[model samples]
Target: MSASDDYKRLQLALEAAGLDLWENDLVAGKVTHPATRTFQELGYTLEEVGDSLAFWMEILHPDDLPGVGAALEAYRDGRADNYRSEFRLRSKDGQWVWYANYGKVMSGTADVGMHRFIGVTFNIDDRKQREEELTRINQLLSAQNQQLDQMNGHLEKLSTTDPLTQLCNRRAINERLHRLVSTGQPPSALLFIDLDNFKKINDLYGHDVGDILLCQVAQRLQSCVDAGDLVARFGGDEFVLVIRETGNSASPFRTRIEYLCARILSILAQPYLVGDLMLSTYGSIGVVCFPDDGWTVDELTKRADIALYRAKHKGRNRYCFFQPNMETELQYQNNIETELRTALKTRQLELLYQIQVDRNLRPVGAEALLRWHHPVRGLLSPLAFLPDAIAGGLIHDIDELVLDTACATLGKWQQDPLLRDLTLAVNITARSFEHPAFADTVMRMLEKYRLPAGKLCLELTEHLKAQSFPDAAHIIDQLRAHGVRFALDDFGTGYSSLEALKHLKFDQIKLDAAFVADITDNTTSQAIATGVIAIASAMQIEILAECVERHEQLEHLMRRGVDRYQGYLFGKPLPQSAMEAAMHSTLGAQMA
Candidate 1:
């Protein structure tokens, strides 16, 4: 086909398709198009639209010209693949309408007359109007919700928002921690910040000044963390930071935490002028990581508290990561005592019995041991808190509970044939043993349960003071009269004296665990075990070995005439329900 015929067919197709085809002679500054469709749609005449590129510029919105010019420049300089502009253009009626223009700049060659910009245009006013309307509706909804919050956010604000610094409170942090952990996106590090010398500031300057200083410190703490990271006021002079994102390895992640804590210390060390006096204070930060230091909120907070104490003790204005050994020191005894009291009050105390067995490893009886189910620390044995309990004057109370619980279990066992004959031993504190009514309490328990003969034994520990010796004989005599057995516990560890004391009638001598542990290896342990077994044999008293864990140790002790054995080789300590279940299983096996 001829060129003119092909061009006419192309123009006809474009016009039918609602596209306005246009071209510009760049060097000559002239405009041409196959049709005036775009101009007619926007209420402009062909004559008014004019033949010059300058006319198009005159009608374009001033705000859009700069963008159009940049697009044109980029295309003309070969920096862009094509020239495309979305802009508003004024119509003959003086109303602005949206239009999209697309074109390609081609240099003049033999096929064309001059350098040309060829393109198409489409009026997009309706689509633009719909987008603007949707945006307006969203903004209106957001504004209305904000207004509602301002008007009716009473209890919600009181629970989550802090009144003093306008930051989050500890309660909010706890809730957020729960949500985050539930969603499997818990924070990586919890930075617990405590201001140094804050109490002195409160004392030297008044509490009013202290309050203002705290508010200023809260602001600085917010500045130290990221936008999504949580910053909360954990109480007076104490702030907490929850870091939302850190790498997931222990070593590199801890490095980042160390760097972040250092940066916070550096930033907060700056002096702040509150009212008239310039206040200078720095922070000590304790850091704990998720899945490293702990996973739960209670555990993390407990670990962070320990870390913070260490930081302050080592000297102020420093940061410390949580370490396992820190909680083992005497520094935490007071805290343990306080929380242990709460544990007892809240019924967090539990008792587990390690099944004691005869020579054939048959379950005979069990030892009732106390375990503390701390809310933050999980299940803990006696060594973890007994020293503090003793110093805090709580051991006596603890013993009373243990004694009562053991007796109750014994009473429950009387209903089942398999469990009825199983003797249960409970440790008795020196304080409880010395009480004048101690014998009376034991007598009542013996009468209440009608416990089987030799089924309830009171194991006397080495904690008895010299003052308790005077009354020990009388207490022992009364309890023995009621068929309650007495065992001298830890026989070789310095309290081997019921024999030497000459007044007490003890039924059993439990070989101390220290000797049983190394009976096969250590000569001294062998000698002690042999001596204990020999004495008990001559006296016709039953000799039981404690902590007889290894098979070798058990075999050796049995050879040496040890009458009974208790330790992990038989079974671990079990709760009451578990103990009953185990007894039932054993009874079923024996019957089969």
Candidate 2:
């Protein structure tokens, strides 16, 4: 065949295979037979290309040059069996498209004038793009799987661990106890520790400090126990320590239990550092032996509880053992419940108002606080007897009375312009507010007194249950429509404080007294207060400072943008007559 015929047939074969052959003259430093169809397929015309090595070099993407050179060098050095490279080339449309080439060097033979490189160039853009996309999808799936694994691990941890102290939770403790019993391990002593005066510490220091104290106590408890021993947070203000091996003999075991309990009491009683303040608290321990006190977790917990109360009853900061005659605590509680019932009916329960003032220190409103006048115990604060009332389910009755008296007081106040604008904030328990007739009763009182619904502010506590929020929202919305402004009481202390804000709209949030207790001296409290104020402001909700008992606290709060104030620095809770008189005095001064 003629050479021209052979060249034509080869070109036809290359075209049929979806490829184009190219020849580079190494000595001439130019491309002789260019990949014409490759350029044409990428939207480049023959006129756009000058068919020079420079043109090809200029079109090669800068990022792909090193890899292509590496492949060419490896083949030349005989390190690679074949020379192959995939690279991006700048197309006619000013876009980069992927192309690949396979080539071999042909030495200058007797007839050849110079060394020549032969190669076939083909478009691999679709395949390359698909491969890249598949890689990305695989990466996304791998990341998702890792996140799912993390989420599941977190869920498992939550089930077995206390979120706050990171100790074994009640469920975990129960499981551990069950496992020990099932395996018939050495008898373990379960010491039920109820921190003494924790409520007082929590109330006086704030929940922030209280939380810190709990964590510190958990750490101390862990430090006191052996590695095999388990220390768990059984409940709020409660802890359980399990001694894995109490030994077989009674004398040494009793001595060991005594020593451990005494050590825990001493260690726990030591002062705790919360923020900048050092506070002290003690624990009352109830010591019980497993398989001896009772077999199951429930029976052991129940008996331990009895012993714990016994320790509290005798005196706080001591340990007690479960005895047959330890049923005295129940009777005492029942007796108190009986007295509370009597106190409610006999008008011994009364309302007191603590003045709420603006930034200017002028009275804007008053929070209606409850006081109990026990016939035998003289006058007492709600803190003294409210627990019994709540425990006996008599808080709803107290709420009813407070609402009634507060409305009557509101009705009387409106008769005088001086006191009409002063709002009365009444605290309502969750159960009381959730009642079917609760909204009607409130509206009824407002209508009967002919008072503005704005004058009677209902304070919802931070401790409202999440499950009842839907219904609570309905009632709050109903009352809100009637012009009854709601305030979130104890805003920063609850677990779901921010969640509550998200779910229910409120006119104001009473920053918990705990946050205010040490705000002036504590930077943590300052940051928390500042952050909360900022959040509340973003929602257009007013911020009210609670327990602002010092001028420094008030100044700090004012600078931080608090809208209102209430505490001992203002006025202590007083009777309706006294509260009105003080308001009258303050209003007269303001007018003058």
Candidate 3:
């Protein structure tokens, strides 16, 4: 075949493969392309064939120009055997298209520096676009995976930590205990701590302040522990500490544990400054040693809990070690709780009325005191089963029974003119009073008994005075609007302040028996009593002296401007029959 026919066939083949062929003559400073028509179709023109490098540089993307120029120069200088570069060039239609260029020196002498190059320029826009898309998708997936990993880590942390105090939670602590027991390398002691009167703090300051106090408590606990020990919040106002001993001796280990417990108690007992209020609280700690108390987490936790209960029962704000006998006492207490639950259903519960008299010894009111006549055990006072009732979540039931019985008695008393004017004072538990429906329930009971609101007085302990129940003032106001009166019972014996008394409206304040017990001789007691009376008088609240058994005590209280009195000096608590008989006799008239 002739040379013209072979060149035509080669041009047709290159066109069919979507390749544009070009040749550059370096010494001549000229460039030539075989497919002029193809170049026009791709939005380019080679009208100025000479100075091709300058023309290509003009068409190239500014960011890609330097890289392409460097690649060409290296190949020309024999530093690179072949030239290959990918670059963006602006097409005639104002769009940037990716192109891959391949070239080699067809004729060159390295020393003389004469060179002619031939290469193929291929349109790689589609492949390059796909590569860019894939890169973007990979980056996005990587970011999403990282975010998911972060979220999972946060969830794991949340599961193991107490959100309020940021301390290890119960589950985390239990798991740590299991791990430690499995290793069995070191002797460890577990201390169970329960804050004393924590509920009272929650009630008086509300949960917001309560949460702040809990965080402070957690910080104090952490400060008391060593680097190897762990402090975990075991829920509510309870915390558990895991202390590992370095030595093998049991005696020194126990001594160290006791020291830690004492230190913790001292630190936690210090007052906490929550917002504007300075509050005081204490902790009861129960200690148990591994191998000595139990081998497993459940057993040790149970024993520690029992010891904690014992600490609380033994005047609180103290620490106790686990003793085998405590389990028996715990079981007995549990049995008492079981029996107390049935006391009301079996009609074993009764109310004894304690008479309250005015300054003239006139009967003005009576306090309904609860009594339990156990089937096996004889009659028991509130102190005997009240704690059990509270722990068993049955105090509300007892409180309701007292309210119902008192209202029923008042309903019958309405028939007698002498007793009609006599007010009935019923003691209310803090839990019952804090119930959302307490006010409504009390009003309903009064209506059911046809008892006028003025005929009833709700006696609340001084503990309730410190609680920050948002609706407390509202509830009190609502009841007072219906003529119901309230009195602060056991007045000088609780954590109450003048600020609380100002906000909590009370019709009267009762002097606790302790304050009145030796008022005549004890100047401090007399002064306290005097101060209370003066405060009550200034607040327009009546003062009632309780446990006034001696004439000197009575005279002292009378001299201090006490409005009413209740104690054994006048009469002890009486049964329903005795109370009715006394009311019908001259004794009731004299008391009235």
Candidate 4:
């Protein structure tokens, strides 16, 4: 076919495909295209059918011109096989339209004098607009997802943390402990910390000040632990620390754990500044090492609690390790507490009277001591079960029982001429003495039994002297106003002070048995006992020497001017029937 016929057929084929066919003559500096109508429709016109290259250049978008020029140059130099680009071009109305264009050097190579370029252009504005809108929506969704992820992470952190201290809560700590036990990686020690005297602070100050103190405590605990370790607030003033060690080996870790515990104690004991007030507190720690203590969270927690009880019991502000014997003792105490509650109702509780004598060995009064006759354990002394009663919060019931028994015995003795002259002394726990109705209860018992208040002496331990209670002095004064005698029992053993002695009225001071136990052999004991006696004498308080098991001890106390004595040497604690028999026999001998 002739070239003219082929060219016309080619133009017809390009028109049918919705493509615009064009040619650029390099030597002539002119361009020709068959689709003049398409350009006119886009708000552009070719003033001449085959115009110079400047006409197309004037209509191209400024941002896409450089790229299109680069692509065309590469194709003309034969660097690329074909020239193709997607760019925006200005239309007749000044709106930008997207177009895909393709061209190639059809007439000659780069070495030739001139080159002819043939190409096709297609309008792509609709497809490009759709793609841009889809891209914008994707970016918006991605940003929203990132924000939601951040919020979810924050909420999860809040759930596992304690808001006040910003430490792990009980649930989080339990999970951590469980993970530690299950993995068995690095060895760890769980230290249970209980703030000593924190409750007293809350009672003295307000909860606001108490909360500040707790926050300060939490900061102190965090400062003492390593970064790998965790300090969690287990509610209130209690905290649990997970101390992560280097390896599974425990021998070398023992010393480190001890040092850490001592360091924690020292740190927590420091005074804290809460607002304008400076408050002091200490911590009692209970430590249980992993695997050695237990293989589960619950087991370790229980063992740590047992050790904590021991720490508090031994006197607070110290740490104790879990001992096997402690578990056994705890179980036994639990059993005693369960059984002691029903002892009184079942008529198993009895009061035994231990005789108190004057310097000449004549009966002056008797101390009412509690004894439990258990169905399974036979006769049990207070030393065996009293602690359990106190721990179980049932000491008040036992105290009331003892008072009732003592008052009934005194009422009965009132009818006996010889025994009526003897007084009765009942020991009162610090807990019971602080009761709001303690004084009223005592007065009613006195009135019911028809016994003079002077004949009933209430004994309180020296420990009660250190505790500050607003009503303590008032209670003592009220009972004393009615001629009720009071004695400082177990004096010189606890935190007793001269100020306490001066403020609280006491008719007598009973020396603690520990001092009398070795008063003759130990010079220190003798000096202490003598010093106590001198102090009591200066106060004009009657002195009573207790646990005097030998005649020499009695003689020594007598020479020291002691007025009363009670010990095994004089007589052991006897039941009411035995005491009655002994009292009658003594009366019969005196009459003889």
Number of the top-ranking candidate, with TM-score as the measure: 4
Per-model CA lDDT versus the true structure: 0.80, 0.83, 0.82, 0.83
lDDT tens digits, residue span 1-592, model 4: 9999998998776664556777777677777443464576576556633477776777788899998878767666787667777688777788988876776667776436445777777665665689775465346536755223332333465567987888898988999998999998667899999999898899889999999898899999999987788899999999999998876546688788899889999999988998789899999999898989899899999999999989988889999999889999999888878898789689799999989999888888899998899998899988888777888888988998899889999999999988998889999988888876788899888888998658899998866745553467888889898878999888887766465686788899998899888877889888988898999989999989988899888888888888999999988999999988898787668778
Q: For residues 1-592, what per-residue lDDT tens digits would candidate 1 score against the true structure?
A: 9999999998876654445788888778888552388778778788887888777888899999999888777666676666766789888889999877777756563124446778877665754689875465346536754222221233355567777898999999999777766677844788899998788789889998998988888888888777788999988888999887655456676677788899999988999888999988889999998867876789889999889978987778999998998887745677777887888788888899888878776788899999998887788998888767976778877887888889999988888888888988999877678766788888877777677667799998766665456578778777777778988888878853654335566788888888988899999988878877887888888888988788999999988988899988877899999877886787668778
lDDT of 2: 0.83
lDDT of 3 by residue, 2-96 (tens): 99999899877666556678777767656654335435655665564234666666677999978887877877687766676778877777888
- Model 2 TM-score (2 dp): 0.48
TM per candidate: 0.44, 0.48, 0.60, 0.67
The true-structure Cα RMSD of candidate 4 reads: 24.5
User: Higher TM-score: candidate 2 or 3?
Assistant: 3
For candidate 2, write residues 160-266 as lDDT tens digits: 89878989999888998889778878768888999977887887778988999999999999999887889999879899988867455467776788898899999
Q: Model 2: how large is the Cα RMSD against the reference?
A: 23.0
Write out the backbone clash pairs for model 3: 203-467, 203-468, 204-466, 204-467, 204-468, 362-591, 362-592, 363-591, 363-592
User: Per-residue error at 537 for model 2, in Å?
Assistant: 0.6
State model 1's lDDT. 0.80
**Models sorted by lDDT, best on top:** 2, 4, 3, 1
RMSD of each: 25.0, 23.0, 20.4, 24.5
Question: Which scores better on lDDT, 2 or 3?
Answer: 2
lDDT for 333 (candidate 2): 75
